[model samples]
Target: MFIEPDYKYMPTTTGISLPSPKGSRFVASCIALTCVLCFVLPSGYSYGSALLCLTCIPLLLWFRPALSLTREDLWILSALVFYVIAHFVIIQYHGSASRYFEEPSRFLLGIFVFLAVIGFKPSERSWWLGLAIGTILGGMVALWQLLQTDLPRAQGFMNAIQFGNLCLLMGCMCLAGLGWAHQQACPRRWVWLLILAAVMGLAASFFSGARGGWVALPFLLGLLYLCFRHRMQRRFLLIGLTLMTALVVTLYLIPQTGVQLRIEQMSSGLGGYMQGTHVDQSIGVRLEMWRAALAVASEKPWMGWGETGYVEPLVQLISDAASRTQVAELDHLHNDILDTLVKRGALGVIALLAVYLMPLIVFARVSLRASPEDYRLRAFSLCGLLLVTGVIMFGFTQAFLRHNSGVTLFAFFMVVLWGYVRLAEPKVHSE
Candidate 1:
């Protein structure tokens, strides 16, 4: 945990000038390691994070972190609790709901991860190194798979969509972190290396044919600009756009990357869907699933259809419309909002929205008053906002939280960044 919280009476920020807890650096390193472990391993790495959060509980009995919960912090903790309770409420603690409890529990337990950050204040260097190394290696693995295997898309150890979307999200994290890199020793070297890592992460996603996450790009870049506009020259924006355009063109032209084929398939899917010719393609299937999800939600607006309960009625709805019911065969409603609406109903929707919006409220409030010269604070805030935005956008086409990768990465990584924000003590100031 952190510097031993005396939460009853603490300063504005956890920026105390005191020796850190003995062996706290070791604990901090363990925390940082999870960032890399996420991309390198399958579901195994998230266990490490969960373990760290668990480790904090006993330590809390010994001494609190030298920190206090701000208004925003309560919101963070409350959201996690709400998320967990919302799950049990929806399923009535029955069937697959018991097994599905694992994901929601991570959110509730992640409170310790936040507390750990407040106490130990993990080294920023280790965190950045972990991401840079993890993403680069992750990309290499995907590249090897594309070039060597018969599989059309590269998926390290999970679904191609999950693997690719995480890569895309983390890659954007690196890009958003440019300000932090600029402040390091050998600034230019750190900057370029991070840029390269960002490219590798994005490239891996393309190779995986996880085009679903690509929909977030324009908004993601816009957010990055907002976070770092003070530091960027007009010419820098132009250069960035040029590089992004060139990367897209290159990937589309390269046959082995599979980006070209994916784009073509998407175009054809959209073309056929509109013209009403091949209405059973990938896009059409997802579209029909969405329609059915809405119709089904209308049937049971407040208390949703359970995991398996929704299928019969959903199929019946599609049949009544004389539309393809193949989507019922799928496990989830492709959209996260719709999925929650279908299974958990309106209350679940509230819980899910709280998870996304509470964190945004916290980070955006801090960033508003943060000085432009505070690169680390700004970077953390930018990454936080990007995390929320990326997840929401990713959820539009896929129920990302349905997968293990979704819950683990978003819950823990969120607290880690919030911890950094706490360390920075974001407030009105001038350099």
Candidate 2:
């Protein structure tokens, strides 16, 4: 019901200046509230995002917010369509048909959230500010968990790995917010608060002993360097780097922390797996699972084993009852690439690639052409790239997309940023 705008048109200013309907702000506030709940609720908050998405459909239908699509959007949308179709194919192949009704609904809800962002054009500052606050609160909860437990790892609200991954993402967003604040020459205390929030989020990840997020940190830092080196003064960069190094060194020196021990275990496990002597530990089990996945994939290279098909075959390949049990319990292959290859086959791989890479290409391109004044977009592009990097890295040891949090976070941010990018038009004077 909304009027269509030129594909390339967007607001030139930092935020959109549309004359939204009287009730649009109310709906926007509801979305914001959902975001806060998503952050504060330790577990099952992905459903909160889904709920937000469901609400968007009726709002979009009633208000008819402006909508535009770009080439990148088309690529992403096409991938989603193909993925849904692939599930239908799986049903034809007599795979688990119930999954068709289950998982895709979450993704479809994500699509609604995407459309709602474009249509509503909610306040950028409010959205991000609320997210920042929620992130800080989440980080505090993680710290509290660490203090309350005698366990080696702390996972507040979610599992250790997911919590760690979330902290890393929140850390990245804080860095981008810091950069945006600096660009605007905001008060020093405001910048300090952003830095504090980033530090706390990162520290929580370390406390959680989540190796997956740590694996992505180097690349994340590199991205930040590239994003900030040209934008800020040299002294600030040097100071930030020094402080980061000091923090790492401090964490390393702490005797109670399991980071060093975990690294040693990973190395030993990998070495034993390579030497063909041990196949019982964590890393060893992952290797075994991967090997079995590869075999299953080769057998059904084109269309894959379907939702429920891969399990029994993989279990048969594993000789040890314990190992077989472990394999059976795993919902999907730990690796996203492998899981897609097994379930959706080669076509699913292409679709999955499209979903991940299209955003990278689109955001990177937008960032390159962005002027110094476009701090909001620049920060957002970097945040998107960093978030995607973290998720992909996490996927190496886990089926990230198979998880609700993974689906919700990735889809929500992608849409939020792209929606604004679409709405960003060169400022036009009214006659």
Compared with the true structure, all predictions reach lDDT values of 0.78, 0.70
Q: Which candidate tops lDDT?
A: 1
**Top candidate, metric TM-score:** 1
Query: Model 1, which residues run further than 4 Å from truth?
Result: 1-23, 93-96, 319-325, 426-431
TM-score of 2: 0.87
The sequence of per-residue lDDT tens digits that candidate 2 reaches over residues 113-158 is 7777666665555455555665677678766776777766867666
How much is the lDDT of residue 342 in candidate 2? 92
User: Model 2: runs farther than 4 Å from truth?
Assistant: 1-24, 27-31, 42-44, 183-186, 319-322, 424-431
